[model samples]
Target: MKLLRVGPPGAERPVVLDGTRYLDISGVVSDIGEEFWRTDGVERVQAALAAGTLPEVDVTGLRIGPPIARPGVVLCIGMNYATHAAETGAEPPEHPVMFYKAPNTVVGPNDDVLLPRGSAKADWEVELAVVIGRRARYLESPADALSYIGGYCISNDVSERAFQLETSGGQWSKGKSCETFNPLGPWLVTADEIPDPQALGLRSSVNGEARQDSSTADMVFSVAHLIWQLSQVTVLEPGDVVNTGTPEGVAVSGRFPYLRPGDVMELQIEGLSTQRQRLQSAEQEA
Candidate 1:
């Protein structure tokens, strides 16, 4: 099932896409938040759809917000893609290299990403994001990791190289948490709908020029393995957002110029959804 949150920024309402139509599910569940997902929101939405009593919403002026509202933890995996690591002059990690993005960075897919103060190296990372459906702590093996996931979404792991490399003393979160840094979702495609998340093709473009175009198969550590590895150390709860990492074509590779005000970034993943963000001055958000 494809689930989405539509409306203006903070007032987004939950809706489900049935073919090309968006049905309002807010009557059944308040919003697609932690409580909704943790309490079987998927099943409830399914039942509501089966009953054929949902209201059809005219999504004409409604903005598509991040699919899962108020995600608990925005966990990210770095160097998950071998080529991406090579492009940034880093070796493949022996294990998943993790980082945290402040949850407030979550914004609508089409929202304008604000350029941080004195930032000149704003970059784009088109990543496949995994949304947790159940709490997982210390799983048995990688084989059993998919069971804890609810679905998948598209996440643009926007960053500023200066804050990430030249400043923070090796902590990556500083560069990763600017306003609208993480543009997530057009929808949260349920796990069942995406039988194999690793085989999808992902691409990103800056101002209509293609940049990163790669498949998830190139990942050094698969989704299941990352989940299993993460579960070994921390408890991943329902509604947690996990950005799996991007491909090689980022600005840091020196192949393209960094993002500037008015630059448009578009991200696409096969079968999942797409996201586009316009670069704006930081004060616009202030």
Candidate 2:
């Protein structure tokens, strides 16, 4: 099942995609959030739809917001793709390299991305974002990790290289946590719908020029393994957002120029959905 949130930025209401139409599910759940994930919200919405009780919404000209609302943790795995690591002049890690982007960086799919003040090296990373369905702690094996996931969505893991590498004192979050840096979702496709997350094709482009074009098949660590490994160190909570990492061909490799105001980025993952964001300058400090 595909789920989404619609309306203005902070006032989006929950809805489910049905046969090219969006059905209002707000009456069934407050929002597609922690409460929804905690209470078997997907099943409840499915039952509501099956019973013909939900109303169809006219989504024309409305804004599409992030699929999951107010995620507690925005965890990210760095260099999960081998080629990406090589492009950035690093050896493929022996284990998952993790970092955290503030949850407030999350924004709607088509929202305008702001280039932070004094920024000169903002880049785009298209990644498959995993949404946690339930709490997971110390999972016995990688085979058991899939059950902890709620759904999947597309994430544009936008970053600023200057802050990330030159200024970060070895930390990556400052470069990644800029406002509207993470553009997520046209919709969230439930886990059951995506039988194999590693098989999907994900790519990105700037100003209609192809940039990163690769498949999840190139990932150094599979989704299940990342979940299993993360569970060993941290508790994966419901509604948490995990960006699995981007593939090769980003501007960070120096093959292309960094993002500038007026540049546009388009990201897509087969079977999930597409996202487009135009770059604009954030107000400069006085």
Candidate 3:
């Protein structure tokens, strides 16, 4: 099932994409929140679709908001892509390196990505984000980890190198938590639809020039492993998001210039969806 949120940013209505048309399931369920997914929202929607008759809406010219509501936590894995780490002069991590992006940083997929005030060195990272379907605590192995995943979506992990490296001293969140940094969705392709999460192609481009082109196969710790590993340390609640990290060819490598105001970023994950973000200054947005 391809689930999405459409309409204006804050006033988005949850809907399911059926081919070229979008079904308005708002009458059946509210926002696609934690409670919704945890309580079998997807199945309920499927039942509604099976019944055949339902209200539909035109999404042309409408904004595509993040499919899920503000997640409980936006967990991230750093250097999960071996080649991406190499480009930044970092060694391959033996274990998944975890981090977080403030939940409030999330915004609509095509919304203008803001360049934080006094910022430079803003970069792009096209990543595959995993959304949890249910509560997950200590797990025995990576084997059952797939059961916890609800779906996958396209995510651009926008970063500011100066704040992440120079001014941050050691912490990266300072640079990662800028408002509108995480642009997600077009649709959340449910887990059942994705048989192999580790084999999808993901790529990104800046203003029509290709930047990162790689696959989830390059992840040091695959989605299942990351979920299982994280569960051993903390509780993975429903509606929590996990950014599986990006591939090579980021601006930080010096091969390309950092993102500046007026820059445009396009990102995609195979079989999922694509997103385009136009860069603007904080002042421009104001």
Highest lDDT: give the candidate number.
2
TM-score per prediction, in order, is 0.98, 0.98, 0.98
Candidate lDDT values, in order: 0.93, 0.95, 0.92
lDDT of 3 by residue, 53-92 (tens): 7688888888889998998899999999989899999999
Candidate 3: lDDT of 217?
Answer: 95
The digit string of per-residue lDDT tens for model 1 on 46-117 reads 999999999999999878899989788899999999999998999999989999999999998998999989
Tell me the TM-score of model 3.
0.98
Model 2 Cα lDDT, one tens digit per residue, 1-286:
9999999999999999998888999999999988999999999998998999889999999999999898999999999999999999999999999999999999999999999988999999999999999999999999999999999999999999999999999999989999999999999999999999999999899999999999999999999999999999999999999999999999999999999989999999999989999999888321
- Ranking of predictions according to lDDT: 2, 1, 3
**Model 3 lDDT-worst window of ten:** 52-61
Candidate 3: pairs in clash:
none
